[model samples]
Target: MLKLSEYTHNQAQVESHYLYKSLCKWAAKQPHATFIVEAETERKLSYAQALAAVHELRKAFGPAPRRLLLALPSGIANALVWLSALTGGHQLIPFPAGARNEEKARIAHRYTPELLLTEQPEEAEGFGLAQARVMTLAACEALIKQAASLEAMEPLPGQVWLTTSGTTGEPKGVVLNEQQISWTAEQVRLSHQLTPQDHGLTVLPFFHVNAPVVSLCSSLLAGSTVVIARRFSRSHFWSWIKRYQVTWASIVPTIVAMLLETEKPAFLPGKLRFMRTGAAALPIPDLLTFEVRFGIPVIETYGLSEAASQVVANPLPPSKRKPGSAGRPVGISLRICQPRTDETADLCDVRAGETGEICIAGPSLIRAYQHNASATAFQDGWFRTGDLGYVDKDGYLFIKGRLREVIIRGGENIAPREIEEVLLSHPLVREAAAVGRPDPIYGEQVVAYVVVKTRWSTQLAQELHQYAAQRLSQPKVPVDFIALDTLPKNPTGKLERRLLRAREQARFTAQDVASHTA
Candidate 1:
């Protein structure tokens, strides 16, 4: 995750504050605005009821651990508690409501919470429940049934904590204080000039700050209505856009591709003001197609969990909005820092047009992790963003790609060496380089370019898939396999994955082969 300092100086003045206080302030101002609505569900809340529920929650769980896990959908009740949890003096830890029952239990054990709020009581993982209370959506309503209950307390400054990708390597928890999150939201509101007339349709998981802080919080702060979808579905994307009159939304490249591949919705929603893509680079093709179809600007952005990053965004109004350039530093400054040999030495910034590691420091950025002392994101004051991008003479920042040597398959991370080592063990396989290729559903799926001495068979593909599936998660398994007669390498014999990927994809098309038959 990129640190906020690696980017700007405007961040130095960020004051200490808590998120709960922000909610209270917003609720005090506009208590009648609609906060959230779950798709297909009649259940929802106006800002007034949302404030009431949040106040009840604060009273129920007084000052305690600053971390709280919100295992609920992106509905009205969920949104209310989500704000309450963060503003109620806790970090909201959200997880995908997938089949991973044990993982939820594990998190409950790992981050002991003062409260574990969910819509399902029976779903609570076995451990960490004795002391931690279980309050479902129905129970939350019951609290109101008794009487108007409100909790009063000063907000816990520096209370926000969010998680980014950590499937295998040490899970790094990106910690940001309440003030940083609020400021970032405020900046977006000002920079974009968004107003209550806009209604945001947020489908990204709320656990991640991307959905909450970026899309939802920004909308609410502007008094704009927000329509929350529990999960993203390409089938219903445009329908929801039209249904809710969604003006703004943030999406990942993978979802954008899905929309492109699927039949264009009956009609593009006219109310969509803008769309932002982040969490990964927007594919060139997907970016162009989306705008052509929707007639809306497809803005791009750069952000990280730590440092409250939100480094840059597409330019607005009269300025020509570049399609690929993440645009100049929005609400922040970005510079590439060349690492020096000295351990304690400060890094130097590279000249514009020069390629180096992107370094950032800003008000939106955070200094450290929550209870995690092992994080090495900071150097001097700037945070090292493990991304390799360059700025043009126009001062526009364009990200080339990730500096992290991990394969992204379908928006999932898989260490390359892990797949390489596994494939090399096969008796017929000679060598391998696992790289990612663009896919409609998965953003990028793993493709292995291989050199083999023996004949390849479908059995081999199944065997490799099974091999990796047992040892690693499903996302790490290569969806596409390339078998080559010889290794195409440099004179020094280093395998050229870029060349191999081109060759492999070319052969598949040349052969006119349909997707590998089962």
Candidate 2:
């Protein structure tokens, strides 16, 4: 058991607001309590040992409070470095460890951080950064082995710099203070009803905000244990859950689909409570099937990097969890508002059950993008999420799609998710994506790309077209059905509609050239 003091030097303190400070208090009360476990090596770090490691790594960072960029894989070393930087009062900028050299260099040049940390010394060359600014994880570990004197420094709350997914364009940086992170972590802890006995398994990449705030920080505030995996592995996923007796895991829809397509384990891990899915919408059919097949409930969630990860999540069993809804807002003020076209006009909230732009405001939300104070997303203290959704009379949120993603065929607007749901309901369709293609008569026409369970054929496309026509209106029906082995997705498993739209445009361009030449 760990004990946290009610007051620090006669001043009242909120334990959850400062994570590293709570960690130090936990170490003082119970030195040997388990805190983090490395899934690959089964390495356990007690509270006392974790604090010592943080201090040892801080020496390498020195006493300067500068921005530190970390480009390392998810593991014990990466966790320690992150803790070291945060507790030492340094700002953190995390880049994906598996990103291409071009991407790494682009981020490095864009942010111009004071220090760059990586796993290998040569990585600095690839990132186009000077070697003097680079610090390798191996070097940090060697320094820890030396066991130098520990320095006493006050735990200072600093900003955490993160970037958007860059799905539409270049990724923009998001700045979050420690207080915001603490608020979101507490929301996750309360939504899931986490306790000290709960054991969380983290499979999402550490570069993303989900892994750190949703998984690590939430578990820390709950006084629970967390097992960190390098990445999501379908082959080793179930085995790890059984081996560690994992109570819950945070995952994406891509992982959910992969698990359903693959074979199941010989026996289910009874200790596992549920799987939390977010970052992208999970088709309703897949969500129900996953629950029925595995005998485990799938909790659907909605979040983004701007909000520090989770905003809304379906409650656990016996709580009236809706199947396709992202549940209600947790610890935040959520409303649907008319899309802002005129900057001077007052923002108006939409009535319940009316589709509009989703907006959020709370302690967990970021004020503005880093280096982008004039960004239009922040208006009157509310962050416009750019997502189109509606709240039911009961308060459950139903996402339609992005405002930019809506297809306007002639005069009517169409939601891609509506067509996607109908396609996924077909027994033969395994995966589906809907996008708008340019048209001569109508402004834009609906096109669908699907991955079938069996071989593709001309008749199969016709069959799918017929199936959608029966379920959808004439204007909403897909004019073209394209067969694909797999739909394009981002690294985090979000469907890339922009790529599909580009493919359609190129196809039409080539066809026009052929017709003119002939």
Candidate 3:
């Protein structure tokens, strides 16, 4: 394995080159290299065909619009539009295709994009956008045929706008320019030791940074092929892996757990080097169990939409991979800092090994949120992440929990992850979430919600509580344990703790009213 200093220095070179231009250059040189394979249709596009398709799509655009709103599903068409929008010099905002109508309206009203692209043109009314400004998949396909063949055009600089997962409040729009996007992709390619022989499997939505920057763009930078799936189908996941001969895959922790729950395939397909999991905190037990059960190592990574998907990842093999850590900062600078609050912008003062806010700065990180400068304050180019963690002596990053997710009990600050991790170690607990519930006595008390593999029962809840009691201190143990078939998760499969707290509060209010009447 290369030394950390050597890796950082080598990756520094990739920032100078634009990813879109490099992709085009590589495509023209290696025209015959397989670039994309659509698993649903068993369709494939070689680099030559992909380049031609992108050119056709660009020509279809005619004049580059100021902003393009994309709500296309995962497939070859969506991939083409993404490349075309970036290369043709148009600001792009790709909304998750499965987003709710209200969510779509919120963005459309805010941005008022010049063009809205979707798989279903009839649904354009839902966004309250003019029909004339909307282009359906059919329209894009028709334009592709009418597009005139032309020489390779110079790549243009454009911005890609993305929204935070909105797990807490209204999602904030994050903006990244072409250079930032491409540089981040190159960083991922270099960090993962990607090669032309590699094949990436992407089931993540196009709206997420992981799909575009981590999987597709990184594969392009490495001169590798990517298999695009319409949606994540656990039943067909392993089969597709076998069919496509996939080398590695980009997935979230939820998908990883689901795949593990599914029965094992008779024979695992391809020479799957590793599976990269991120976008949410992965339970340490799940990470270790996956490696033990599937024999494919799970490379845990950490990043945000603002950083263009990956800022750090566990190096590909033969190197030390700390199971619980998010690995070292790759092609970026990281710092542990004193926690910042909403009222003030202060410099970080934490030392190494001291728990604090995880802060980062790099070419890949966006300096500002779109139209929301007040949301973030940068100190010495470092963006305070709001995530809490500390770097170990060996430099691996360990996440404690989100600062907002921290629970306070009788003025004692507690990270929910610490208790959640202990609860998840129970064999019956498939998923667990710990949050603070309003309490008159303690200001706030710990409460837990869990999803069990077996049937829900009072006996089971008691067993889980007793198990947690054995592992956790008196105040750390949950005051209540609620068993559910499944916990509430957002579109990205992250547990919604805020919503859980709200629901629990409402339920308690209702209980109080009933008791007063009785």
Q: What does candidate 1's lDDT look like per residue over 388-472, in tens digits?
A: 7887777667888765545555444456766777788777788888876655456567777777766788887777677666544
The candidate with the higher TM-score, 2 or 3, is 3
> lDDT tens string, model 2, 1-518?
10111100111123543778666767776767777888888988776777777777776787757778888888777777767776677888887664556456667777777788888877777667664388887876676555434334577776788866322333567887777777788888888988878889988778778888888888877778888999878889888889888999988776787788767788788888999988767778889988888888999988877888888888889888898898878777787888777656556877657898888887788888887787777888988887889887677888887655666554234668767878999999999888888664354689999999999999999999898877666766898999899999999998888899889888878888998999
Please give the lDDT score at residue 311 for candidate 1.
67
What overall lDDT goes with each candidate model?
Answer: 0.67, 0.77, 0.77
Clashes by residue pair, model 3? none
Order by TM-score, highest first: 1, 3, 2
User: Could you tell me the TM-score of candidate 1?
Assistant: 0.78
Instruction: State every prediction's TM-score relative to the real structure.
Output: 0.78, 0.75, 0.76
Residue pairs clashing in model 2 are: none
Judged by whole-model lDDT over C-alpha atoms, candidate 1 comes out at 0.67
RMSD of 1: 5.9
Identify the runs in model 1 with alpha carbons over 4 angstroms from their true place: 1-22, 99-102, 105-109, 126-131, 141-153, 165-169, 262-269, 339-346, 370-375, 407-441, 446-518
The Cα RMSD in angstroms, rounded to one decimal, for candidate 3 relative to the true structure is 12.0
Q: What's the lDDT of the predicted structure labeled candidate 2?
A: 0.77
Q: Name the lDDT value of residue 10 in candidate 3.
A: 28
TM-score of 3: 0.76
